[model samples]
Target: MLEDHRMSDISVAVLCREAGVSRTYYYHHFQSYADIIYQENIMSVVQYMRQLPDQGIITTTTMFTRYFELAAQSRDTQLTLVKVGLESSLIHSFESAFEYLVKNDLVVKAHPSRIGKKYWTEFLAGAVVNMAVRWLQTGMGETPAQMGRFVSNFVGLTE
Candidate 1:
């Protein structure tokens, strides 16, 4: 199969030539390319999130560290997410993760002397999404352990 071949047209013919597998065998494995991508890419995100500790149970540093840890594990899917245009769901997932942090209080709530607590949550969540997108575009830049320190400093995560 040509590297430039459209995955949207990765039919039985393509798979057959690429893997030396018959059409029937391909069907035995995957219903369609999208089906495989859904089962593998999307579901893996949910699984990875499930594996993450609830924010209440861990330190703020651990929370952000685990964020990158999960992302590193799913780097391919993260890139596939950008390549395949999953923006809305990606935003939703980011918001959901942010909410988890807020509800679990892993991040510091903004005091009245500073920004509103809601703003802090939104800011931190958006910052996390930005970090994630950058990581997908390039790489995580630092170790997950180091990422934890960066996150702690960035979000003022001390309790």
Candidate 2:
């Protein structure tokens, strides 16, 4: 449905018809089409993160690059979400996932004793989310490797 309709003024009836599911079943599972989109976006990020190996500057760069690649693959769905004003949910999902990874030591980073880990995680997550949104908004002009390098430089990740 998204590939064909692109979420511009899509309705529950149309979605249900496309999926060949009853409206009752669709409503039972999803509150709205936006909810479905949000869950799919979150699931994609979490699944990718889960598959990432260990933690280090290199791993971090790989994760960022892989995430950008994934986003590039689903650019259409993402753009639709942006058009429908659900971009914040997408950003929040990534921010939450990244924060969890940071807190659990899944992503390597040094934390200052003066500031809490949560604060550092939130700061990093916000920066990354903003960069990602800008990248998507601008048609992902940079390759994943370029984006990874830019993020690595911004975060002071060294070899």
Candidate 3:
């Protein structure tokens, strides 16, 4: 529905109808439409990352690459979020997803510096989210693999 209509045009009632769920269920689970989109996007990345084999920097690069790939595939949704002034939601999603990886020990060897794991994860999450926002805003001309390698190199994840 978002593809065909602007967010402002879609009401919660409409969404509930489209989703075939009761308003009670929707309200019980989600705060708003934006929350629904945010959770869906973040969960998609988390699920994808969870399925990947842990392979050090290789896994990091692949994960970052997949992030870009997903963004590109969801250009419409990305644009809509930006248009609705919800770009921060996208940023938060990336940051939260990265934190989840770090916290769950899914991503290894993240602390190359003397920095604590918490700080290192925070730094990387900020860097990744900023880079991702810029890439999406600027038409994402670079390929996902290229962006992935660039991030890995920039963050010293690669030797």
| lDDT score for residue 23 of model 2 | 92
Residue 148 CA displacement from its true place in model 3, Å? 0.5
Q: Please give the lDDT score at residue 57 for candidate 2.
A: 33
- What ordering of candidates by lDDT runs from best to worst? 3, 2, 1
TM-score on alpha carbons, each prediction: 0.56, 0.74, 0.75
The better-scoring model by TM-score among 1 and 2 is 2
Give the candidates in order of TM-score, highest first: 3, 2, 1
**Candidate 3: tens digits of C-alpha lDDT, residues 106-133:** 6654444522455665677668766877
lDDT of 1 at 30: 86
Candidate 2 worst ten-residue window by lDDT = 109-118
Q: Residue 97 of candidate 2: its Cα lDDT?
A: 71
Q: Tens digits of per-residue lDDT for model 2 on 11-119? A: 8788888789999998899987768877887888877676676444335677677777767777776776666667776677777777676567666553334124446
List ranges where model 1 is wrong by over 4 Å: 1-56, 104-116
Candidate 3 accuracy as lDDT: 0.75
lDDT of every predicted structure (CA atoms): 0.63, 0.70, 0.75
